[model samples]
Target: MNPLPTACKDEVVLTLPTILLPGLGIPASAWNNVKAHVPNAYATDRLDSHSPLSLEGQVNRVIEFMDDRDIDQAQLVAHSMASFIGEAACRLHPERFTRLILVDGSYEERRKACLRIPIEKLIPHATLRAIVQEWRCYSFWANELREIQRSHPLRTRTVVIAAYACRPGRWVRKLRRQAQQLSALFVPMKGSHRLMLDRPEAIAALIREDPPQAQRHDGYAL
Candidate 1:
């Protein structure tokens, strides 16, 4: 793969390594297509699938993974639930991440602490085992979402890509407003929630594109 170009005038040839984080329950192989396009990219395996960990623990694991590989800083590309982990990790340790790309990320209101639903019971038996194994992950995700709601806006350069199918909806609008507040570039792409899997080449192309203009509030056209 060719080295990714920067948007700077000096045309720096150094390409920052990329970290691809999959959503909850998604296998590392899900990022295979995108990984194939970026030779320097590393796709992380599911962090809490087997032995469950708290959200903070997952963030620590991500940092440790990078540190173990001697990666000082890299572009973080996260999808769905992993977006929460990426955002939190970046906020906690801003120096470890150069940029953040949230692909069809989930943005919801802070979860109620007292409201505990039997998620495993609600799902079918076939998926019950997986849910049982991932119950802690689910809990951590909800708690993390609440924390993110009360957290400060991100200072790192950020890009948010929402699915076109979810356009003209309240969720997308909310995400747009959040992006504006963070001065992040928001892009609406033609795909489903699983946009990366649906259009890996397109996703990879966007990842390879130059970073968004710093402190820009306007959204980008496809």
Candidate 2:
């Protein structure tokens, strides 16, 4: 682990170790820019492509990574589909997470469905094959989402950063509604879904900012 710079008394404080999880089919390199600005943070490799297909398996991978590094607790930053994995991990082990930061994430429940064609067999490229395998795990994703919905109002502090640029109004509204449902702090960001890639500095700032005291919103616990 890297050491923090020396500081005068009351000048500097430690921040929670941060774990960055990328979206489905997106490489961990997508978080390189954001990682550059964060200290004591680690970005997970592309688990959506090569890791286990089941959500429980993916969550286990994260736990194992933390355990290997002796990280007892961390702040999770998840983007897109990885939000499902992060939420599930936190739900299963809430004591291990200090905060959950979800970027451009959706909590809409999904139902399992079979793909008519076997794209993996048809596609020769390795990258395409990986994507096909990820798609094949739709049932896992659906089951995880269902479990998260059933276990709402996560014990860990939660924040939802919704991207508004170039996105449909309804989609943005849906994200806002989901944030409300989770009783999470809602932050509206000006960018596309790939905020970590396009606005890494801003995202890092949000990560480093002190979490606000929990408050009630529309009678919902936050």
Candidate 3:
């Protein structure tokens, strides 16, 4: 791994290795701008290699990447649907997480709304299930995950970079609220959901900024 340069802005010293995860169907180049600014951060499109159809499989792949890098502990920066995979990893093995950055992680509500329509009427149940791995899968829709999140300390911060006319505003608000309750400092950015593509410099600048860390006395949240 290349050494990360000292971030220009005055902030807490960063020593943890940073692992960046891409969104579903997103290429590693998507993180180019952000990674360019964060010298120490590593980017991978490993998930894109297989074009895996399920989010849980994406989560497992992240673990494998961590193992390959000997990353017992590192910060996770997840954008778009990648938040689902990153969140799952953090939940399953909080010991490996020093922090998590949720970039554009509020698209779940829109997903749910889209999945609400009865596609089963148009397609066979098995076909619909195979096609829509996100909605019907227990990996995403599990109430247990929600229950765990309700009281658990996230032990991290949130950076939300939203694009113009981003639908499902309510879900974003909910995420913001949850971040606050966890005592995390949230930094909000505006541009497009494709912030990495449209405003890579700005996204990189934000990634370079330090978000507020939560105070915790217990072990990992998991």
lDDT of each: 0.72, 0.76, 0.58
lDDT of 2 at 220: 35
The estimated TM-scores of all candidates read 0.76, 0.83, 0.64
lDDT of 2: 0.76
Q: What's the lDDT for residue 100 in model 1? A: 92
Best prediction by TM-score: 2
| lDDT (Cα) of model 3 | 0.58
The residue pairs found clashing in candidate 3 are: 163-192
Each candidate structure's count of clashing pairs: 0, 0, 1
Scored against the true structure, residue 212 in model 2 reaches a CA lDDT of 39
Runs in model 3 deviating more than 4 A are 1-15, 46-56, 107-144, 147-153, 164-174, 210-222
- Which stretches of candidate 1 lie above 4 Å from their native place? 1-12, 47-51, 114-142, 145-153, 166-168, 210-222
Candidate 3 structure quality by residue, lDDT tens digits, 1-222: 323346455754545677887765566777877777666677877422233545556667787887897777777888776676666667666788766777776444332322344454565555334345444433343343454566554555544443444343665567667556546544444456766777666555555553321221012120
Worst lDDT 10-window in candidate 3: 213-222
